[model samples]
Target: MTNKQLQVLKQQHALLAQFIIRLSLFYQGYSKAIDEELQTLRGHLGSNANFTLAHVSINKLNALLQEDGGVLRRFKTDTLQSVEGAAKALLATSGKANANTSIIDTISQARRPAESLYDVTQLCVQTITLYSQVTDTLPKPVGVAVKSHSNEPLQAPATLLMALQEELVQLLDTYQKRLPDNTELTILKQKVVEGLNNDELLNVCLTLLRLIVKDSMQEAIISGKVIQSLHHSLSSLHQGLNKSIDQAHCTFAVQQDDNLAMRKELIKLENDVARSDSFSALKTQTQQQLKQVGSALEKREENDRLAQQALSGQLEALKAQVAELESKTRYYRNRLAKQVATSQTDPLTKLPNRQAYNEHLRKLLDNRNINEQSLCLAVVDIDHFKSINDRFGHSAGDKTLQVIGKQLSKALDDNDFIARWGGEEFVLILPGLNAKSLKQKLERLRTRLTELPFKFKQDRLTITASFGGTCFSHGEDPDAVFERADSLLYQAKRAGRNCVVTDKDDV
Candidate 1:
């Protein structure tokens, strides 16, 4: 499906999942409340087992509900488990109570409606607890994925990929512009874009997607820590808001009570003045009381205003701190991304280094075997690579290697992949092909390389590579196969440089 269709499906699935979870929670809460209420009723009957069972079950359920996440289908099953556990706990808790049947019978004769009402109150608390659990576990199963079955991997269309690539370039340029001193993340992003520039992975989109996910995962841990800091900051802000609200409520309640008492006092004073004709004394006393009340109200208002101002300042400070922590976290995360790039990348060729080659080989071999398909491995070594470095300097040698790397990458078919095996040596993985065809393909690549020359200082330098081809067998050890290819490579070198060698040449 297209992105929009996929998004729509995900939204629908999430809605359904949410609805189902809500229904399950409602039923679970209702059942638990019933069990707790029954436990209370049974308590009067002198049976302790039933109430204890319900208590344990409700407690267990509450624990699970308090947890961060749970699988959707596992929810109803968990609810049932809690119910059964409660039943079992009740039976176990009441075993001793059942033994004293005579005492139980005496209590059962005197159960009251008030006790029942108290039981109902306990049930209400349990129901509230269930609601809390629902809120906590809410937005549960956040992802609802839709999978498709197609022989070919689903890929972003070429136009979309090109647009995305351009957008990414613009975004990175923007980031570089904003954070000029931050070289680590900027370098990594450039390298990532460089890797995606190849037509092979971009055409399929899966490899690019995986690379993106890998990069995201690398930073996600740091991002998660930053998020935790924000969470704590938000919690503090929430506490401040709650405190301010409580203060306002307390202030209002106190003023209300004081005003009511003041009204009573004024009424009594009015009656006394009417009976005794001491209107001046009554007025004086009433004014004094009113003045005192007004003073207290003013003081309370001033204190409240000051407290609110302080809380607001503190909340703002907390937000700013969170922002600073996030920026710092990104710095560390960028450093980490740079470290990964250096370790996995070949600095000289700007390609996947030896470790990457090994990893890719293993994955490709495993995949080929699983599919029972043929695979081809070619070991390419440049002819007299050291002589070029010695004669023209390492700069010339480096330029040649770079040109070769680009040519190798571009010359290969979409299904083919190339990796920098080691210094001056490259490994190619060609799936769904055998040794005979690999030789021909490498010969063509060799001819193509000889035709294209690179400028080195004042000289136009031509490069040639020797190919050692081998067919991959399923379930064979990767090292052993690589050793075989290496041995063939030596044979090609010995026979003559710039030539292809395979098992047929062994004779």
Candidate 2:
């Protein structure tokens, strides 16, 4: 070999070895086996490296790369399967949809061992968008906007999912209030509001569904009873009508018989008079016939009077039956009304519940002249409430809630509204209050809560709460206003509880 060619070959070998070491370092921590192989390859290429050693390490790295490629292929397959499964679940829950039928068909017809993940990914994205559009059309809760004061960015899917959850929670609250109070229902609703994850949320929703079914069944039973009562009343009315009809027919036949007998007596009298030769005989026959006619007429009058009395008795009975049925109907109707009111009422605090709050907020937002009116919303969370519950019994906690609810209600104006949002939280809607007024009002309430004399198990304690409030700006989103207010409330929470945070000046 020529000296210059040999020197060029050595330089090329040195460059190749350096490249191999760099490549091995790049593959570090991919897998334990891969890492170990790279480590050994690095050692072989270190300080005292030669052409044969470089060849061996390069071959080993190439084999490891191939193995990693297979793993990547498997990962891709698993991810596609997961996506397909998610798509199926969406279809199952959403029911049949004609708009996405082709997409669905493509997914269903795809081979078990997917040929292309890219195609699957595209289809999945389209399906998800379809579902998103449908969900977006659902009625969103009033005062739920998606602006957060956090560093973490909120993705569209996550935000939509949260909106759906809020809607669901609101729906459950509505149902819970309109029905009767239940322990299980209350617990599930609280968990849902407190932000249970999606998997746990599904389980909670199922439980809530069962409760709703139970309530529906109860309502059905009540309706069935009402129907049965109506049916029985109608049957009685029918029987009364039939009996009156038969009585009328019997009276009619008796009257006809009496008339016929009276006619025959008169005719016999006339024939006897014609046959009589002496005037005295005629007079006697006439007298006897006239007496018989009088007796028949009297009997007919008595029969008619008795028949009238019998009819009067039947009518009275029917009237009593109708009155009783009316009274029962009225009673049940009133009971149902009471139940509806009860459903909207929080049993613990005897205040309007979250369902009531939702309705109230909706009305305010929907008002035609809402822009002119000053509307303010606030959230009050009792500081260290869980601690109270943990230390004292639930009864104490219940009492504490009741006292605070009443005090807060009393502290507000009559036109203002207050409700038990859930647990140890309360919501207030103060109309005709501007930002400055809102801040002052909230501060006053915060102080008032601390002043409340609370005693639990012979231990005197002072209770306090944190407040977050925001006023609705003209043409601003009601939900955005609410979100801003809620964010402030948490800020208050973070700033040592028992304080008021508001977007009064900012708004």
TM-score of each: 0.41, 0.50
Off by over 4 Å in 2: 1-212, 249-278, 358-378, 384-397, 413-416, 429-441, 455-462, 466-504
- Model 1 steric clash pairs: 49-90, 49-94, 53-90
Please report the candidate that would top lDDT against the real structure: 2
Tens-digit lDDT string for candidate 1 (251-324): 67766776676677667656656765566877787777677667766766776687678668767765776676
Question: Please, what are the lDDT tens digits per residue for candidate 2 over residues 1-507?
Answer: 999999999888677778878977876766776788777777776777655765776687676565455445544553454344445434434433663474455445432345664665676576667666545544445897744376654333444444445445544655666654667767776776566666676687677656654555466556667778888998998999899999999999999999999999989988998899989989988999999999999999999999999999999999998898899889988998887687679777889975577678878877826457789999998998767866895568778989999999999998899998665778899999887889899999999999988888899999999999988877676556655776788789888899998874332
- For candidate 1, the TM-score is 0.41
Among the numbered candidates, top TM-score falls to 2
**lDDT for position 476 in model 2:** 72
Task: Assess candidate 2 and give its lDDT.
Answer: 0.73
Residue 165, model 2: lDDT of 51
